[model samples]
Target: MRLTMLTFGLFAGPAFAQPGPPAEGPDEIVVTGQKRDGTLQDADASITVLDAEAIDQARLRDFRQLDDLVPNVQFNEAGQLSNVFITIRGVESNPFIVNRAAVYIDGIPFRELTNAVLSQVESIEVLRGPQGTLYGANSESGLIVIRTRAPSRDAEGEVRVTGSLFSGTGGAGIEAYYSTPLVSDTLAASLAVKYGREATWMRNRAAGVTEPGEIEERFVHGRLRWTPSDRTTLNATAYLLDINAPGLFDNDFFPQDRTLYDQLYGALNGGRPSGRYGYFHDAPKRTDETEYVLGLSVAHEVGSGTVDAAVSYRRDRSDSLGLDFDFTSLPTAAGRDDNDQRVTNAELRYASAQQQPLSFLAGVAYFRDDKDNQKSTFVGPGDLDSYVAAPVQTRSIESLSGFGSLRWRPAFVRDVTLSAGLRYDHTRQRAVQREGQLDLGGGSILYYTDARLASTDDAWLPRFSITWEPTDDATFFGTIARGYIPGGFNLAATQENITDPDVLRYRSETMWSYEIGFRVRSADGRFRASGAVFQIDSNNWQEIRVLTDETGRPVSSDFIGSSASIRSRGFEVEASWRAVPGFDLSASFGYADATYLYLFNGIEDLAGNRVKLVPEYDANLSARYQHRSGVFARAAMNFVGAMALDERSYAVQPATTMIDLQLGYENERFTARLFVDNLTNVRRFSGLGFDNLAFGTDGTVYGALEAPRIVGAEVEMRF
Candidate 1:
């Protein structure tokens, strides 16, 4: 039989149902998306939602599976999964997120802003553009929300095991859901646990490569619900996550030709091996992070409206282990002393009656975050050759913000709602780097206190959105918003300066966006459709530039209107169809035009500058099907357009295509699935080149490789 894409009708989908109205499931109302508890379709901002079912369907284990799912969201992770290159809507691509994005798990925020691996995520929501009011932190571009499933109230449990060929490794997971009645009329409790591990797909014929490096993660979620009387409920939920990922960076090739290596000898340069057959064989580098979160929420009915309050707290700690940095770079065997984060938030909301044609929600929030980060360096004896005590850097950051929004329904229009929001933020940030003069015997003598300087910043953001319903089955909306990112000290800018220091303090950035979208579904609810168009005007954006100032410590330079402008315009479209009984299909595609609008300096870049690794056009299209007969099969594919690597729009990474196929079967108690990612073994660079120019030494941080094509299968049975 010929396979076809899921076809759709003309009607838009349904409006998001508010709580108490009861529509859809828990997965639709993720806190990280809108923080308003609504479906992505009803949300005021642009968002991408990836649910566990969809995650499993795609045979996803890591962020590779997340690529292109969201129009401009790409993994910015480097050397290890501990760093985050997360930018939203090209807001902070070659620059930095500073304020472009903020990450959250449940209602608690992850204070550390790095390209870290996501662990225990039941669903990942990417909110495009600035989200300063609803989410705190540096949410200038938007936000990335990760929601982990909580323990269920009703008792249920399962265990799954899968073995795949290639790495000779097996994967296993056991999950338990238990609920116990407490105090009969007052309380009930629930708990859950999950764990899994797999082997690496890449084979290194080079020296030093070994075993046990496949990605592995474990998750725990638990909660308690208490009801003292009707119309009132109290809930407390807590969760823990532990994740370990081996070295993440891949080297594509060297800049100069390999034949030069033969003539130059190892002396011509570091004379590293041929980049052609690069491999990782030495001790594997690792990033281990653990996060814990707990939240308490209370809901009470007040007349026609409802009053709800929630308080949440979370702590995340990360540690880097082993002899690793990036490939071809110095072996960085180091650790940090203060790699910890803490966040606390409290919110009160008044929601109007949903049954009434006109209803609105007004909320106010207060949040506080404290973080301590310290960097340590240790040089290795083998290939590194030269050795010295690595410098130590410490950072402390804090922020506070407030937000408000109002929604109104017009008397003339029964299905349309209009909303507006405004938010104010104040933050205090400080960084200190003290160079140490420890002797070989280990007696420490502090060298430079002037090497450390501190600074502070403040800002405000505004947003507006409108939702219109031509009919009960169709909805349309438009949004306009302003976003920003905070500035900080650049470590590289310092070392580059010996007598003079690189200037300190990088300022904040702001970007404005306008968007219109539509969601439609057929009368039978069998077919669904949604689409959107957007244009973003970026102001005072940030990017790296070689400066002559000795104190020019790579700082966040504020553009007082010299035209560091950028324009990002794009379209998002999707369709979901049930088509036939017991058979389901879905497909989505997007088009984008991302580019710098103005030339910062009349001096055209000769190296052919491209801002960062944002592609002009990128898309993802997938199709999956399951038969009512309890038999299922699936096939999917991904497409990527060429991306620019520099600011002058000069260097470019050629684009490529990939295809994946999946097959699965499910019975009363068992299920099996076979999946292939990049089935054709297409290898691509996950992102562009980046470097710490302050070294006073040139470290060619270029051509970082990404995930190779992977083909694997999974099988599971529940009892």
Candidate 2:
């Protein structure tokens, strides 16, 4: 398909322009996914590129808006800002396994789930296969690279305001960006600021609150660029983010037993019955978070090549209180969580010039992460005096890696290229969990086990690819790659009945992926198409599983462990056509068949089951019409197929289709737009959590509700 292009000449001139037909063939798209700049058509990998214009057209404020935009990929949010997860090509990500894929934002690596704010972003590249040969650990499935706008030499600024109204909720936001030169051709500075507040669709019935899930967020980003000479450049950046959300947790639980749930909560006086988006909780639920980041980078031209270096430091702190575990007003169980994390990263790399017939890239990287977490559960009142169980844990991890890649074009082979890359990583992790005694009230005390664990692991990842371009308009390629995810100790204490050491400290998981792809475009550049087919096999697949005692009774919290082997295969295709002047059409489709080859839970072998949270198929279609008079209208539809919610296939989310519409007018100085998202108001669960063991209910499921219909308008002005 024709990748969307949005160019804002922020430093030079006007920032807004009307869409029109290109004078010649489609625009050439450049990407830095390989640690070097190259055209997307020449890259031998599956990638999706979205520029700033596409991001604005879709109103993609956060990562969750990328649900159906890419093939073989899905984005889900588990009811909170820090609980987002992405599933790629049947490989699922959860709260425990948050780093199935790696994310890099402006040279900063985020192993854990972050807010992922998309304001002032220049471009985003989604690489669909394993990127371990370059990214190292935590990239077993895929990688996402985000590049924000850099400081420009010219002075420019913009201000934008937005408002939205959804079912039973509303929100408003504002953003501003400014860039100016400090010295002529020597130094420049840029700054961006954003603030927003929105009320979630969820309501609390027992508490008599209309909009309990209100959230407020603020962000500030600053950058300085200094060019000491024509051959060297230095850039430094600082970022801050703060969020406050009331009555929102990582996941909200609700009893699936309709008969029992209604019997317990339906007859309450002046209270509505609990449902998917409405709950019966009387306790105060709130979450507060803050993050600070600083980064610096340097690039220097060395004869026929360039050397690049970067370093970053980040600190995150969060506190949450009042989790109604029972999903009722009776206060049977409640919980709280507090977390802190600090991360430091550094990397140095060198790349040969791209014009040569042969080129090479080498890099070395180091990373360190420290985390402290505390979780507490209360039985009677939601306070420390009623604590039934509490656990405190601390973990430290360090990783070092070296990677290199080479690309060659043999003189004997016309229009063909070969590439190979490898990376070696060693990681050490140490953790301690202190599960102190629990007070069950009335002087009743229960003691739990405490443990300390440490482990060191190593991985050698490799990738190979070959590409052939017989004609300027057509390119074909094939690739094989290895991906890895490091192992770590579980934070939960070992149960008395569990004897397997693997449960306490899981082993690393690995995957091998094979793929072949082709991209073709019409001579006139009016039509473009791309297709790919791929297969992946995984060993030592890790997942969170509940522990049971000798009598088959539940013990402690769930822990990560190696579950089984998995095989996934999929194919995807995309096409875009400029039907006529000022009109365009684009479509994409994906299909995947993923299943477990061998699954054993220490008791029974359950194989051949479909992987959880993976849809069988997904598709998107869009049509747009733009007039020469600076007016445009667009319509799009997205479809997602049915998929199992859990490993046991107890619940399923049926197939769903959503439609969106947009109309706008734009000019050099002012722009306005009206949009409607999820026009049909399709309400379905995005994720599921089994709470049968925690609540002592027969098959109680805690579901994460999807967003409802939203109607919004936006206005922008440039100076």
Candidate 3:
């Protein structure tokens, strides 16, 4: 039994590490996705785990860094603090619909993926496939769980400083973490803080601005834990984050036709083409954002199980000034946005002892969110006076869910286990949008919309799995799961000459996923590997659509449910090997075939088109070598395949490769490191958007390019 557990741990997840000296063999990895502590194999799911050592080695300061390390997953960053999307297994997430997969930070749910600071962390777990049976709605694609380091009985602290240069831009940052015992044997507290500033890499040629994308950020996190008795425990946590970026949304625009590049450049510039990071926007641009979170949790031991309860509150606010809708120096149009959001979440659960043949977990959860949004379009000269259209809206969402899971191990067949889970969720939403008015100096046009709108949706998600371990070195599993995303009223729903109810409210989206997987480890523990293949069938997939008038001119846009059926099939494999005493190698590869089985929009038929924003394949390879004298070196290469940028497949991003290298020396008290990311200086674009609608040019397209080659150094000291 001991050997069986050791083999399972080695093949369960990607990696794990302890705090002190390195172990001779792989460390055991425990996961909490089932609301209880258990091995990754026990969870009956495909998951990726990264511990503190891996994170530190990778220099993972933000979510975007995960794109190169994780297979079949991509983190799309729009060059702003609040603009981020996570795509998993071809289930893409866009700016408008941001929560394809749910994210949890220390048990606090964040439906919208924000670019939060990742510092002083413990472990990160990425779970692929639908997790609605345990996490509820907004987790149709998958889930990401972040567990922060907790306070310890002994006093400990660390301080770090880093400096970096990327794409002609320079940046510096500082971070500190401290944890100590508050009382002799009952209470402990921890605190973490971070500050960073970066000079803009972009130059606004038209505005004569040298650095248009300057950014600054500050973050703080604190927590307290109390163990009143052997059977009772409590925890309280609070965090605050603030960011300010000027001209962060200033994207570069170019012509679709290669031959027209010179013509477009001559028109924007004075007969000279723009640089790689140069744009022609003249409007004033600014973005400021702030967020705060508070959380509390309690646990108590019962007769044969443990009861847990947790609650959290979060508030987020942002204000943005300009995007240069026309993508030119001419002040044809600019935009302004003000948004505020508040969220509250609570959950209670009980888990039976894991040693029993029959173990179970049950939970009930509640969630509420309120949003106030205002958007305005400024037109005419200087984009300072006169309005094209302005609208203000308020929305409220509430949800209630109950979920349960059971795992049974038969006495007759100790090697086989069966697991099942189910969850029922009900959601309600209410919204009110004021009529928008457009004043272009000639006359005033009114865009009328329903003053009050409401929607209600319910879903029942279920999952089933079977696991068999015939030998101590090998394991096999199969699973089937259901995923769901609730429907909601469109923020821009209008009543003027529109009669179809479907246009105002979209239907829910659902999918069924089937998977089979295997895990294996060598008897000597020098090698471990895992592989899985899956198929997903989806119905009523929601898509963003533009509303056109009688003249075929675009007016407004909204999320609409598509009648088309979609399918995604994929396979992923990962392996790690210790070649020698101080050398290790790892590699991963993934391939996905996602397409529209059948589709008929109002204007065109995209029956066989590939799904937008999903890559065809991705691969990664890395090697690390360490010396007994506390010296180490690592190198990694990542590849991403081509992907369609739009449903019509009119535009696409070509495949690209990136390489990173790191060298460091570490000891008990001090450490220093040097690293280079994107060593080849490859050009990577997150999105390519066509601009032919209102306040746009006919043959122009815009995109946000990722930062170029970055070179940095860091130093850390521990006390």
Candidate 4:
């Protein structure tokens, strides 16, 4: 069967694309749920597809390790990559950078949902729950559709590159991608780029330092499409990102010093970086991103069905420059600038035309976000950072939305089928603030912010699904959802006593999800399995209160909302088997028994905090082999199972597994790839921390996760 679908598409490319030939059959699949065109066992809910040959054989530069290989998904990123936690089934994450997952690149919807990134990806449709109607707002706990690689309608495009090596003072980098087509059927375009430099396997103590803090990333994208007939279409896209990293493996912001992190992990029990710890330094950060997109699509018919339309526009800009202290003896540093955003969105829809078994959808959307900022904090040089400059903040956002959906196949449940949707959003917010004091020849004065303390909010989201197929490869599903996240104004300052309590009185978090899934394909195609069970019900639960002082630094706090109650139940299993044709075996297992049933008022020290960087159980196993002239070989293993580091609750960070190897070769255009990650050069620590040694408060930090086991390769050419 086409070499078993190209050895199951070589588990999605990290080097050379595989999984070729499938214009039909393999049980037809391509879905965004009720957005239309179903098949993934008739789409009902719960979806996970990586593809792109598993992002070039898992060289994955921030695929967030595919979050435990998918299931109750959770991927947290801090420091340089900033806050990127795309949680699912956990009901939504609320740490910082207000992004509770809601990203899209294909149907356009990414005005900064934490700028989800995964270079040149061609497929990555996560979709867990509460995707209002067709997906709107932060989506509460689901939706991550990032589909790139467009601009080839009648012919070619290809390019590839890879590099990596990390064990101690991290360093190694590279990645690239390309595509083309100009008038073969209208217009086309594509692009991808990446760069890296690594160092900082941590051990910085007084000039006994070594090369510390290093990492850099760059991204670019372009797209254009147009078709006049055979149904209509138009598309325009743009993207850019630039970042300078000096710390990317955040060990959850150190300084809760546990004997200085057990004397720096017993002075390197898992050692490397032999330069006797010399040259360690801190305080560095720089990030910038720019994006703009334009889109249009149309389909016409009418008589029986087929009448679809879509429209969109977007503009975004994000900026950051660092060292305010992840520590290097906190010399208080800052050179920040944010010219936030200006966005626009438009969507018009109509579905149900063609050969109808009944289909429908509608839409109207508009959005605007604006911001400007400039800040400063310095010491020792440049005239005290130019006398402490200022212009702190400015913000604005305007939104209006409407959405709809429907699908039917009612005829006495001929194997049943039904889908539903709804979405409504109305938001208006404004904030302008500035405050930085210290004068009388000490220079530094800025205070401005108060325009009747602006704010506004409104949202209504709902989505439903049900799909049952007695046969067709087997399928069963059910879903109920409600999600949304957006609430602002809090530059820190929490009041507990004497007058002062208007940090824009923020609060708004809602979630309700219930899911069930099972999709099987066996009959004779070897094997493919999917199973899921989920439960999410949350209220308020946006908690963060760290106002330390007395050497704990940070004395600004105001990020509250907690009638606190969170519950997430999960179970997921994934499978793939061919075992004979060219050899293949894929497996995944997940189990998340989350907690925090409720907590309010009495704080009770957060009564049992077992929900941070969750890891109840996780596993992934792979075996691959393919040859016919397009050589291939694979062996993989990744497992993580213990974590939970903070929230007034004790500590834990254990459970490690890493064994990866991949080799590839392709033809018909040109392709090559190689891989190896922690292939046993093991020296683990992927986050989960604390060490508050009794008031003498030791303070130590280490964040350089799995790099010492290095390897890299990538090459591509197509046209």
Q: Looking at candidate 1, what is the lDDT of residue 592?
A: 59
lDDT of 2 by residue, 200-308 (tens): 6666676544337777878777888888887788888887788888776645655545556676556542445666556777555777888888888888889998888
Candidate 4 C-alpha lDDT tens digits along 510-585: 7788888888887665787888888887776665554444654343323454456677788788888887887788
Write the number of the candidate with greater TM-score, choosing between 1 and 4: 1
**402 Cα displacement, candidate 3 (Å):** 0.7
Q: Pick the candidate with the highest lDDT.
A: 2
Instruction: Report the Cα RMSD per candidate.
Output: 7.2, 4.6, 5.6, 23.3
Tens digit per residue, CA lDDT, model 3, 242-317: 7787765423333344335446545655565666666666566777788888888888889898888888898988
Each prediction's TM-score against the native? 0.79, 0.92, 0.92, 0.33
- lDDT string for model 1 (1-719, tens) is 00000010000100111224434422233333564445554666566677777666666555535664666665553332434456455555432233356766555554344433333346777777677656644676667766654333344445554444443333444444455666675677666566656544433333444433545667776777777777777777776777665542222222223344333333322445543324433334455678777778777778987677777877777654433322233332322222677767777777766556556666776666556654443443232222234444556666656666677777877667877777777777666666654221112222434365666667667788888777656778888887776666664445445333223455566778888888777766677777778888876556555332242221112212223667777777767787687566676666556666654542453322334666655566666777766677777767776776546444466777788787889886777877666677665655444332122113233434454544555566544
Q: Comparing candidate 1 with candidate 2, which one achieves the higher TM-score?
A: 2
Candidate 3 worst ten-residue window by lDDT: 1-10
**lDDT of model number 4:** 0.56
